[model samples]
Target: MSKNKIITVQNVTVTISSEELDDYICITDIAGVKSDQSRSADIIRNWLRNRSTLEYLSVWEQLYNPKFKVFESEHFKKQAGLLTFTPSVSEWIEQTGAVGLYVKRGRFGGTYAHKDIAFEFASAISPTFKLYLIKEFQRLKEEENSKERLEWTAKRFLSKNNYLIQTDAVKNYLIPKSNYKDNLEWLAYAKEADILNVALFGFTAKAWRDANPEMAGKSNVRDFATVNELTVLSNLETHNAQMIREGRDKKERFTILKDIAEYQLDILNEAEKIKIEEKEETEETV
Candidate 1:
């Protein structure tokens, strides 16, 4: 379940619910600020009757919601700005299959809208209120991003530590058995690490260096990895270390790690696709 956050603007408390990368703000709370709480739904209905609002909503749905009912939206478009064209948020959602706005029940219940739509709704309240809403929402997002950066740095550190564990396994189990001088021990470690590099990234450290010579001196492939890649890399390192202790050959370990990398990365990538979709939606809004 998504958690709800509260942000106050102009002394009115608004609830924000995060679903993956999309943020839904409580438009009902925003409406309450303009008038009384009981009239929030009426204010939203009046806003929905505007022709420009209908056009904007239709464009947004077309860009992001493949299943959006274009025919139904067109029906609404023709009636927009007409005195008889009053539409509720729930009615609009049900008719157009709109994903931008929704009504929740029970705890934290209200009419919630995507940040893009909520900002537009705030404009109807007043330009000043809209600006304040944007400012507070941006502040909340900045705080979240700061926490995420810290967490990512901690994960990267853990990945590096796990990498050391893998290298130590290579030094103890593989180095002594092979004919490698003390001066060449680092080569053995590098080669073992390459197995993981290739499994997760489809390239070795040297291959990455050769491809990007400018960055080679300053950073390696791991430095360019995404949070998801780093997470899988850490797991691959731990698994490779255990496999090394079990006397598994490089070829077998590589195959196993490759399979694990593909599986884990696929799941993580799927989970993160929402963020990418949200970015595209934001770009379209811009």
Candidate 2:
């Protein structure tokens, strides 16, 4: 058998009863073992002979099974409560368009029907058992949802943390050495900062200006960036300046930039948990 994707709703052991029929069958989790080795034919035959059960089954078939033969169902209904009524799942399905009826043969066999049909069949087992199946299924879903939320939260927080680290690095290095002779020297410093801006935002100050000619005078990128990205930018500015003073090789600078990018990616992933905790606290207060 292929690996079964077990679905637990309430507490039901949901599995494909038969892939050929595409049936979703639910059984009680507490049921010791499911076996059809016994003399089940007689028991099954007797169950099908019941008048009320026959009516219910036929009604269900008519509702869901478009191929059900009303003519055969009429014949079965007439003999349902009569003197002697013998019925088999195969016989019923063959005669009428019944979605379910247990069978003993065939490859994609051993009782199979659609999910809705299977849920209805579960009633034949026990009502409380069906409820348990649903409950367990719901619990599984909630757990999966929680896991996904946590992952997203962690990524955001990591991004925020790395941003702060980079910012602090900048404050230590670049901010202390501000001196200029003319507007051009100041422009050079501004241009250097724009390298960090380009790596992060894909735009330089001058490019932003040319694009938005009307709003050319103001700083556009600073306002739009997240707190974390800005922090990283500051750190980069300071580090780059320090490296320039030491006359570091181009290869060394490039290597540092690569490391910083990887570090930022790692922190973004880590930030998810922090984000989730904060959200939970806010929710509790609200």
* Separate clash counts for every candidate: 0, 30
Candidate 2 matches the true fold with a TM-score of 0.38
Candidate 1 per-residue lDDT over residues 151-183, each given as its tens digit? 879867765565556555442332112222212
Model 2 lDDT per residue over 1-286, tens place = 3223466554334554433334344232222122232543454455567776677777776665566687888787788766577877678888785755544344423444445544544555556765665565456557766996686456557555644565655433322222221122323344455555544544456655665555456535454345566556666666766665445644455447546744774585469668979999999999
Q: What C-alpha lDDT, on a 0 to 100 scale, does residue 230 get in candidate 2?
A: 54
Model 1 weakest 10-residue run by lDDT = 174-183
Model 1 regions lying over 4 Å from their true place: 167-228, 231-286
Give candidate 2's total backbone clashes: 30
Best by lDDT: 1
| lDDT computed for candidate 2 | 0.54
